[model samples]
Target: MSKNPLTTILEANIFNGTNYNDWLRNLKIVLDFENQTYVLDMYLPRALPEESTHEERLTFEKWHKDNRKVCSIVLASMTNDIQKQYDRHDDVRPIMPRMSQIYAVPDQHIRYAATKVFFDTKMIERSSVQEHGVKMLYLVEKLGDLKADLAKEMYIDVILQSLHPSFDSFIVNYNMNGFDKDLHELINILVQCKATIEKSAQSVLVREASTSKAKGKGARCWRRNKGKTESTTASAQSAPVAPLGMGKGKRKAVRQSLIPKDVCINCHEKGHWKRECPKLLPNQAVKLISANGLQVVNRSRRLRQTVLKFSNGRVVATLV
Candidate 1:
């Protein structure tokens, strides 16, 4: 068959195939955008093995090596582009908002960490002039239960003693009493109460504070008596101390632990005689006070807390 010279030449070129694998190996040298500025992504396939295999199988190890080379090139190019953009800046870029210098401290004078405090003052009438052969002395007498309004003052005195290790002789409020009770023992009990309340209250405060602050609100509950809210306590101060049989036991005292004198054999709780126990009575539902002081009706659930406080600084607490 007669053929044109150009067609014959093209057929001859197709027949003579080039070795692509060899071409890749020769281009193995790394190329930088500007001398050592940055590198552009490039890949080069490795030469084939000398031996032949009946089953052609691709392996992840080989694929990964090629992928790594390609990634490094891309990364280098990105780095170069960013550096160029930064160099072209004509005006000074504003600094990022100074990283917040977070701290656990608050910047306020009246703020307190943990510890209940109170201030107290009282007026007493006394003879100012000394009669003949009489030695009249001026004394500042301690009287009255520290009132709520003066709590801040009392807090200062306590805080001072706590801050000054040398003032160890200063007695905390709970240890001071007119009665002959052992002051040391009373102080220990008070310490335990303070510690417990401090820990729990701080946790609650921290959480609430964080949430409130996040929502652009004040961190404080703003309630002076945040934890105290009961009617009985409010009435206790004015309510004439009921006779010995009437005053409920105060659990703050460490000497005695409170427990039900009589357990229903059916259910256990104080303020109830076994016979009067609702659990023992057939078909009679039992209504009991919960930890929150809410009345819940149940036969199996036991009462959680024994102490009850009133708003008036009176507490009805039980020792466990």
Candidate 2:
């Protein structure tokens, strides 16, 4: 218990009312790792019945102890607002099933969150550009799954915008040429470009090292050229880096998703999905794309990223 596996997962991802699905899976993983999953599967009676054998009583005692441990872990994992509501008096099922109901937000909120995350996503420093690009693609896919309308150009631009400044030249060239390419092709081009930039940097380093080796004439010549270098450096530093995606006043735009026709399962009427059916039962809850639903969305700060770093030292970041 001293080394809880849930700590790391919880540190990165808290329940926070919005990410229950992820928290639930992570908690389950903790239980499974500790060989305590039976606490959830085997429901025990509050008290032993008369004539119950010693074996039955022993099983009940162990189950009760394990259930309390799991319940404590569950409550500790949740945020204060949520933790205060659940009373730990019985098996874990009673508590979790109700939470599943309470944590679900409206589709309108989900749609808004998804859209915001797509726009605000920025590539992490030292991470793979291809990975960053792929994550952007996944965000677009999530928007699509939510039935949010988006233009192809917006999708492409959003990914391009997420990249770091190392890709400014590439972005400018791409915008100028107006090449029509999908997300996969775009990622490939970025991978190649990153390699090229790194190579150029390596060659610069090699030339500098070789020049330093010639201490006599080379050192004298280098010192003589210092003034010219100083002037060039000052001029280069003074000229600001231009923002990308500018050609004939090219600017970024995000269009609202076009609504598709829907047929309600409950009412058998057009213009609506099951989630918002007008004739549903009082206790029925319709699911969206999957059982987990809309997935927990991150509302990251909106970013105006200008740098596409050429750092590939880290592994590729996957879309979780």
Identify the candidate with maximal TM-score: 2
lDDT of each: 0.34, 0.76
Model 2: runs farther than 4 Å from truth? 1-18, 21-97, 124-126, 215-217, 220-320
| lDDT tens digits by residue: candidate 1, 78-172 | 23433243333221111001101221122231122111221212112221111200110011011122112333344334323333232233334
Would you estimate the TM-scores of all the predictions?
A: 0.14, 0.41
TM-score computed on alpha carbons, candidate 2: 0.41
Which residue window of length 10 is worst by lDDT in model 2? 249-258
lDDT of 1 at 311: 90
The regions of model 1 sitting more than 4 angstroms off are 1-179, 213-320
Evaluate residue 176 in candidate 1 and report its C-alpha lDDT on the 0 to 100 scale.
Answer: 64
